[model samples]
Target: MAGSRTRRSSRTRTTSLTDHLKLPDGYGRPPEQAGPQGLDLARRLRALTGVDEDLLAWVWYERSKYTALGGVVLGTSVIAAFSMWNFVNEAIGEASVLALLPAVVWLLFVLNLDRWLIAPQPNAKRRPGPLLMRLAVALLLGTVIAEPLVLRIFQTAVEERIQEDRHGDVDRLRGNLLRCNPDPSQPDHGTPAGCGSYLLSFGATPGGQSTELDALRKDAAALQKRVDQDSHALEALDTEVREECRQLIRNASSGLLQRTSECLRLRDKAAEYRSTHHTAENERRLVRMNDRIGQDGSRLTRSRGTFLTARNAEITQRVAQERAKQKGIGVLERMQALEALTADHTALFVGVWMVRLLFVLIDVLPVLVKFMSHENSYDRLLSARSNSAVKVHSAAVHAMERESMADLEIKQEVTDQYVRRRKAESVAAHREHVAAMNIRERQTVDSLEEELRRPSTV
Candidate 1:
């Protein structure tokens, strides 16, 4: 009865061990049995979430939650793709199929990036160094991804700002051109201050037509001087004649109101000088010169008008050309416009940063979620299984080594035995061959001896 009791107690212990070694409730169960909703999708999306679905299968019913996380990762990739497409399009200043390649590349890169960032979990203890590094990388990627979306959100405003900048550029160009291409004759146009650096010189202007006018003015001045001198000489002569004829002064020797010889001689000489050179012809010549100057001045004014008109037309053309260059509104331009828009307004600055932070958080969600989570049922199971596998592998390797060593010893013993047997057999064979040769030699000697003993044959 005591022996039977011991046997029963051993059986009970065996049953307890079996029970303890059995799998958990979820393990070995079909995915469909996980919940009312199957885990089929959760299994597939495990690749996106960077979680092992096979390991996660035995976990608590977090399939739904992880599936949603996987969806979030996918959504982030889509957002990155869309943002990249727009970024390329905006940079080129147009939409084209060529932008699709980069968009697809970015999508894959971001998908993989999120997976890498979220997938790797510490075996037992969470190391902050690696986690922090991953978080930093995710934040950097998120920051890079946010700009394009932000630009898209403020697209209308940015476009308006770009247009304003374009117009401003055109205005500045026009002002510079006008300044640099000043009308030479019009001093009021002033110097083109600081315009040389910008290369704002416009127009192929001709020299002014003021040469003839200037020459005519010089001639007029000379003629007027001559006419004045002639008139002054005539007036002086007339005043002397009046003084002698009207008795205002008399010769000191003649005290009478008689006509003085000297006065008469002077009057005669003045009349001769006037007859030879009169002021009337000189006055007429001066008048003709004045008229010629006026005509030349009018011609020069007309030429100046033509030059100014052509110069203005060239300036307009230049301004249009400059505006054409400014028409390309690219990604950089939009970013600048957004920056300018946000610089002054406090509310807008806050709103812009908030949107950017929201996008960053969205990108960082997968990492953050996994980081905050403790080791789940799957992790524990994987750890236990991993330890078990290591022990089994080590044992197998040790067994293989022992088996190999035994095999080598057996082979070595067999080879040594074979060599010893072969050596003995060869020794025996050599001795037998030597003995046979000696017997043959003895037989010949004995035969010769018998022949010699038997006499006759030489």
Candidate 2:
């Protein structure tokens, strides 16, 4: 029994010895050798790089499954914000609404846009590497598309508002001018439209001064009155003369005494001719004189007809020329009138736009305040959130510990036996003192030498 107990005690001691020799599950048999300060150094490097769990989480989130949803939410938010601005602006004025578009767009780009849309993959091959690069490219493209839209909306809204005010002002001015009758002597029909806004506003008061337009207007009125009077007198004189000529011809042809005298003279002439020794010669002479008179009368009648035809043709030609000249003049006058009106319209538009621009500037104040407050609130909320650093450290430490245990296992199994052999081989290589480039380095050197040979200078 004493032998058995002693044997059992020996067995227990043996087991305890084996247990002590065996490594813990995680610690490999030989244990890993790394710098004691490795974790501390890693932490310092991370701190220096300003890389942390929150940043990594954000990056992962951006690149992860939620990316598209985030984009949609951002886009929806932008649209909703703009809608709300419009609603509020309706209560105020349109000019303010006009200014809000670009301002909101600016804010979207300046703030939450990148956070919402851009993926932050910092460990990519290139600087600013993959995710952010894609976001930047997307942003540029978006700007190309959206900036113009914002500008157009702002411009159209502003223009419409300005035009409304200008139209109202024009109507008011026109009405006021119509009510205030100018002096009769004033040109432009004493109307505001004709006088134009500038001239009306700045012209001397009617009581104090007379302008060239006024004098010219008076002269034109007097000339028109005289022309009317002369035209009427000429019409009456023409009628009276036609009546007198008809009456004289009628009275002369009807007088009985005149017809009797003419018959007596013709008979006396016939008897005288019969009593003469050369009555045939006298008759022939009388016939010749009568033929001469007939010829003269026929020539006079033809001449009168020719004169009438020429006069009619001249009148027609003159009328046609006058009409063509008048038409050309009318066309030029109308073009001038249109140009003047266009200038007036342009001036009015410019003035109205200036006022609208001022109003827009004022309207932007509220939107600016809202944007500022939103930004501040968002920052405060983010600050209130818990830090993720502890979680990050735990994961990193777990990973490192696993890697260390694996490395120690590999070393114990294989590397430890080979390390001395590797060291001896390295010593032997060093003793040989051969300085030779590797195949890749040799090729690089050859290329560089070739380049140097060809080049005059670097």
On TM-score, the leading prediction is 1
Model 1 C-alpha lDDT per residue in residues 1-458, reported as the tens digit of each score: 44455446556765665466565655754656545544566566766976665566556476677778788889888989998999999889899999999999999999998987777453656889988998999899998899999999889988988888888988887777767777666545556568764443434432444655666788899889877887788789888888877764555787755776767877997888776776677788888889888887777787788778877777788877787788678888888888998996778788899999999998888888888888877667768767765775676566556666777787899999999999999999999999999999999999999987885765
Candidate 1: residue 378 Cα off by (Å) = 3.3
Give each model a TM-score: 0.72, 0.19
User: Against the hidden true structure, what lDDT does model 2 obtain?
Assistant: 0.43
The regions of model 2 sitting more than 4 angstroms off are 1-65, 73-110, 113-165, 184-458
User: Which digits, one per residue and each the tens of the lDDT, describe model 2 over residues 1-458?
Assistant: 44455446556765675465344443311123122434543333223222342333323332222333343334433543554454434334343746577657644553254343322222223334444555444444443333223333444444444445445655554445444434422345355454443222322233222343344445555555554555455455555444443432224666533334444455554455445534445445545655654565455455545544544454445445544443221222332433344366887446545544443333232222222232222233233332233444565566556666776787686877698789999988976655443656788999999987895753
**Among all candidates shown, the one with the greatest lDDT:** 1
* Global fold similarity of model 2 (TM-score): 0.19
Give the Cα error of residue 255 in candidate 2, in Å.
47
lDDT at residue 207 of model 1 (Cα atoms): 41
